[model samples]
Target: MQHGIHPAYRPVVFRDRVGGLTFLTRSTATADRTVEWADGTTRPVVDVEVSSASHPFYTGNARVLDTAGRVERYHRRYGRGDGAGH
Candidate 1:
């Protein structure tokens, strides 16, 4: 790796506002805001909208789409395009 060309990799805090979760991890991402972690150290903080805590799949709040029903409805409204009726 180059000495000065690569971005600084350091410990950063990721905050999920929706889930009210915060964690410390190493990342190349940076932020102007800083936060004091549990270890009594200040680190750059990044705000995120979605995380494992708030994501539907991770939290088991995902909705199963009715794809088959949609296809059936499309066939009824627009036909199957088999060219038999036309």
Candidate 2:
């Protein structure tokens, strides 16, 4: 609640390069780059490598890891022995 102690919050554009998506929001982050938004105004633009649009989890393209196979491989290599304080 103190004045002049907080970063300036303003409208900024987050651009996802991989997904080719852009979103306008308010944040304290700033960028030297600027881009024209859909509202016919120029705003500070920040380029991101990945966002919800391109992320595997958000896009439903995530690959399930084969943990069972990994466990089998580990047992085969180390031998499945009863943990009798060994």
Candidate 3:
């Protein structure tokens, strides 16, 4: 609400580097790259590592931990041998 003391607000693109996924979004972030969108307009493009498209939780490819095996191995190595549960 002041004078010309604020940064430029424009349209920018955030591209996921891992998944090669890109989306159009407005932000104050600057980009050294540009791309043509579906509207035939050139916009700033930014590269990202990972997004929901490639993330395990979002893609439903969640990885499971081998906790049971680790627990059994630990008990056999350092846990009590009386089988009384430590």
Best by lDDT: 1
User: Candidate 3 lDDT, tens digit per residue, 1-86?
Assistant: 88798777888988888777789888889888799988999999888888987888988899989999988998889875778766
Deviation of model 2 at 75, angstroms = 1.8
TM-score of 1: 0.82
Worst ten in a row by lDDT for model 1? 77-86
lDDT digits (tens) for residues 4-84 of candidate 2:
999999999999999998999999998999998888999999999999999999999999999999999998888786786
Error of 3 at 42 (Å): 0.9
Candidate 2: pairs in clash: none
- Which ranges in model 2 have alpha carbons more than 4 Å from their true place? 83-86
User: How does candidate 2 fare on TM-score?
Assistant: 0.84
Task: Give me the displacement of residue 37 in model 1, in angstroms.
Answer: 0.7
The all-Cα superposition gives candidate 1 an RMSD in Å to the true structure of 1.7
Q: Relative to the true structure, how large is the alpha-carbon lDDT of every model? A: 0.95, 0.94, 0.86
TM-score versus the correct structure, for each prediction: 0.82, 0.84, 0.77
State the lDDT of candidate 1 residue by residue for 19-66, as single tens digits. Answer: 998999999998999999998998999999999989999999999999
For model 2, the run of ten residues with the poorest summed lDDT: 77-86
Alpha-carbon deviation at 28 in model 2, angstroms: 0.9
Candidate 2 or 3, higher TM-score?
A: 2
